[model samples]
Target: MSQTLTSDQKDALQEVTNIAMGQAASTLATILSTFVTISVPRINIPEVSEIGSAISKMVGNGKEVTAVRQSFAGHLRGEAIIIYGQEGCRDLADLMGYDEDIDQSAERELLLDIANVLIGACLNGIADILQTGLTFAPPSIMAERVIINSLIDPTQLTWNNALLVEVNFTLEARNFSCHLVTLMPEDSIERLKQAIDTFMENF
Candidate 1:
């Protein structure tokens, strides 16, 4: 089933997402000791078959990337995937005081660390705004040095369509950037709409 959101509902979700992403950006700034900027959140409901190409375009087609995946469950349920370009990874490692020749394990650790921070902070912010709770699975390296187009196999997804929330965080000075894509299946989207409705009632 398709998830349809009214205009006001869409606006409400966007507002909450903006606040949540701002919190994520603040956490990132604190960690990197640099200013971090976030793009306005974009929300879409795309067919599973198109998810791979949609994300590929968001991260840049053909770019080799590393990704971390974390699943959250509770009043809201979804998977948060963080995509990092090669330069972004190197910049992050440098910011974390890694040597130029850091080992593979160390790099993976760095990726997981930052991904956990951003995803946790962002999702928690959303939960806070909605006065709900969410628990996250440990972040795992979903793909290492894989091209964006190949990162996700749509056939492996159980759902035919999903509500996708996309946002980007950039440390401009360091030229480091990552995209956080949150996917919620149909049932979760229905739950989210009800939550949004409840949230708007108070305003």
Candidate 2:
């Protein structure tokens, strides 16, 4: 029987995210010089439909619904989505020195910049730690009403055809929230364990 990745997988995953997240934090810190620190939240595989409400609750009581979807694909192909209600995004944009009268084009431009900083840092973190390099396929903006099943293709990535291990971050100072979906391929599940086992053996 194949060994399942236990809660210990979460701990290991946290360490992996920690390293990448720290790098991401540093990059953001340099850009804004705001001392960014990403929190290590528990990973979740909630239903796709639940994401809107889940994220809304996280940002809480914002009049305008603002969500920016940025997707990155490579060896590990998936999305790194940033979401907030409209009010929250406007407030964040204003705080970040962006003006009002925001439209799709303007918003798209800003979102892409954020995704680049984040996804670049995120990929760098993974590559350095895994001792392998990962290439990006460019980020595309995701629609606000994306259904969960849209991205899950059994043929492309098989960790599971069902759900993704999602990590959410809330920027404490600016109250801007972002989510990272680290997709697991079904076939690669075993490979991850083997890698971890190798890592365990070293420790």
lDDT of 1 by residue, 82-116 (tens): 88998888887877788999888988987888889
Model 2 / residue 160 / CA error / Å: 4.5
Report the lDDT of model 2 for residue 137: 63
Best candidate per TM-score, number?
A: 1
- Per-residue lDDT for 73-121 in model 2, tens only? 4445444544434444565567566666657576666666666766677
Give the CA lDDT, 0 to 100, for residue 77 in model 2.
45
Error of 1 at 84 (Å): 1.1
Highest-lDDT candidate = 1
Q: Which residues of candidate 2, in runs, are more than 4 Å off? A: 1-4, 45-88, 144-172
